[model samples]
Target: MSTPASTSANQQQTHTPVGLIAFAWTLVGVPLAYGLYNTVKAASALFGG
Candidate 1:
């Protein structure tokens, strides 16, 4: 049901840029890592680890 041009456009839209993917992961990962590190530190202190 799709024409060639429209198909190519769809394909382009579906493909995400590598930089954008990395940036998104970094945006989420930094905060997640920070929270995890603090949690582990707190747990260690609580348990005398």
Candidate 2:
């Protein structure tokens, strides 16, 4: 038996805003870049100085 229309699957899509996505990336990328910079600095110190 087919389901009722009230119980049917939704066809609409939810989208994130571009500004919000950019803000989220900036939030994640800044600390990630900082951590990578620190790791590279430590590795260079260990290998050379």
Candidate 3:
């Protein structure tokens, strides 16, 4: 049988540093933003907007 304390200890949370988290988001966000920009550009050209 597992005690509550032992169960909680086993599930200890790991943390990522803020700088690394920001870098990871930037990696994902840059490509996403570029893709969205090109998509809107192409769509505007097609619609003559």
**In model 2, which residue pairs have backbone atoms overlapping below 3 Å?**
none
Q: Give candidate 1's root-mean-square deviation (CA, Å).
A: 4.8
Candidate 3 residue-wise lDDT, 1-49, digit = tens = 7567666657878999999999999999999999999999999999986
**Candidate 1 similarity to native, TM-score:** 0.71
Across 6-46, the per-residue lDDT of candidate 2 in tens digits comes to 54365566899999999999999999999999999999999
Model 1: runs farther than 4 Å from truth? 1-13
Clashes of 1: 0
Q: Candidate 1, residues 1-49: lDDT per residue as tens digits? A: 7567666556644678999999999999999999999999999999985
Number of backbone collisions per candidate: 0, 0, 0
How well does candidate 3 score on lDDT at residue 44?
Answer: 93
User: What lDDT score is found at residue 26 in candidate 1?
Assistant: 100
Better of 1 and 2 by TM-score: 2
Candidate 2 residue-wise lDDT at 7 = 48
Candidate 2 Cα misplacement greater than 4 A, ranges: 1-9
Candidate 1 positional error at 9, Å: 14
> 1 or 3: which has the higher lDDT?
3
Which window of 10 residues has the lowest lDDT sum in candidate 3?
A: 1-10
